[model samples]
Target: MNMRNLIVFSLLSLFMGLFLVLAFSLAGSGGVPQSMGVNNSFGEIKIKRMVAPDFSLDLYDDREIRLSELRGNVVVLDFWSSWCSPCRKEAAVLAEVYLEYRDKGVVFLGISIWDRDEDALAHIEEFDVQYPSGPDSKGEILVEYGVTGIPEKVFIDQRGNKVRKFTGPSTKDELVAILDDMLGSGY
Candidate 1:
């Protein structure tokens, strides 16, 4: 074979080898399966309700909020980060939906994980989010919620039980359906 053809083949072989190594490394580290589990459920609910673990957060507004205090109100816990593209995509939908349900016995709370406070607060402002938001600085909240990635959501019923978890970006309709169900509405 010509020297030019030989060189091309060698380069391609090296690139393929490197790609395989990277892929295998990620898979071996359990990253592949974890990422693959970021389920987007739309409005479907299939999980049985479990009592939500309580948590306290210092909101961006310098106020403290405890999950237990929100009893008797439906809660939506949005787990997101500014660096996550899917989170950014759903920010507007969350903000708009929160407004619609704010006075309907629904409470929307944002938990920013794996992001700087500045970035998280900036994203909140950029999205014009009126809901209370706070940073999960130590990731305790994330661990408790079994969140493996950003853009996950946990819905709580009026009795403070975790009703469902949506693992990726959600739409306005999806949020509405869940909220309606939690509120005992016929929607």
Candidate 2:
């Protein structure tokens, strides 16, 4: 083979070897443990327990939601966009859960990311989302939360610590269980 062709072939082989090593390591490590595993039909969900970053999000309705101000309340921060189908699919689940826990001191805040204000507002109306939702306009809040994809939800405890992150469209049952656990823990 020519020198150029040989160089390309060697690079491809190196990348393939690295990929296989990562795959094996992840498989052998069993990856992060979760109360529920990934359901292929739905999507991948990752669980994380850590301190949540605080931000003051200005909703489209001229209201501001400060994460630090929400101390002593269980908060669910939903990151979504109008163009994402998974976000649309999880809309009802969020609305239903919001209704069920609204009176129970649980707070739900929707952060519309990577979309126009008009589109985000329209999506909220179309989904009939009653919770306080606003556009991430500049995407500052999105970056602060480390959101890599849409339909990711972060659950924060009452003490303003210990956030549980869900990286995909979560089901009603799963949301309920998490909220129940947070509420019952008296944190």
Candidate 3:
């Protein structure tokens, strides 16, 4: 090959190598696959009463549970992580609400995503959370639930229909109001 052509080929190879390294690093970090389209913002997304997707995951205690099995009770599926500051702030509030309404037939499930299992478990324990929680293995459930960010809460009614979603840190009052609405709807 000519000198100029040789130099261009070498540069192209270097760029390709760099791209591969970056791609693999991202994949290793529990990053969602690009085709999943999970990075889309939820700003305009509104929760509607629709059939909740069936998902089964392993809890931190090593037991497998399915969302479908949690029917007949209001389910609060929270997508959060140890690294998310907002999640740390919201965990206590969620715990308090869970304790208050758990006897009233409410089930809270914390789905930790894109984080180490140990860290997730530690955060749950640190916050004194009394909810069924598990890691979203490979982010598959997060993609399915359209979770674009941390601290997202999806509320499902007694009939297993997704009724509402809160995308950020929510106050206790806000959670109470949401619960009241869901209960009033008689779903």
Which candidate gets the maximum TM-score versus the true structure?
3
Q: Give candidate 1's whole-model lDDT.
A: 0.83
Cα lDDT tens digits, model 1, 52-161, are 99999999999999999999898999988776778889999999999999999999999988777777889999999999999888989999988877688888888888
Where does candidate 3 clash, by residue pair? Answer: none
- Steric overlap count per candidate: 0, 0, 0
Model 1 ranges with Cα > 4 A deviation: 1-46, 185-187
Candidate ranking under lDDT, highest first, comes to: 1, 3, 2
Instruction: Say which prediction, candidate 2 or candidate 3, comes out ahead on lDDT.
Output: 3
Tell me how candidate 3 scores on lDDT.
Answer: 0.83
Deviating ranges (above 4 Å) for candidate 3: 1-44
Selected candidate, larger TM-score, 1 vs 2: 1
User: Would you estimate the TM-scores of all the predictions?
Assistant: 0.75, 0.73, 0.80
Better of 1 and 3 by TM-score: 3
List the RMSD of every prediction in angstroms.
7.7, 9.1, 4.5
Q: Give the range where candidate 2 is weakest over 10 consecutive residues by summed lDDT.
A: 31-40
- Report residue 170 deviation for candidate 1 (angstroms): 1.0
Consecutive 10-residue window with the lowest summed lDDT within model 3: 34-43
Per-residue lDDT of model 2, residues 1-187, tens digit only: 9999999999999999999877765673344212122222444355566678888889888989888998888999998877677788889889999999999989999998766677788889898999998877787887877777777788889878746777778899998888998899944
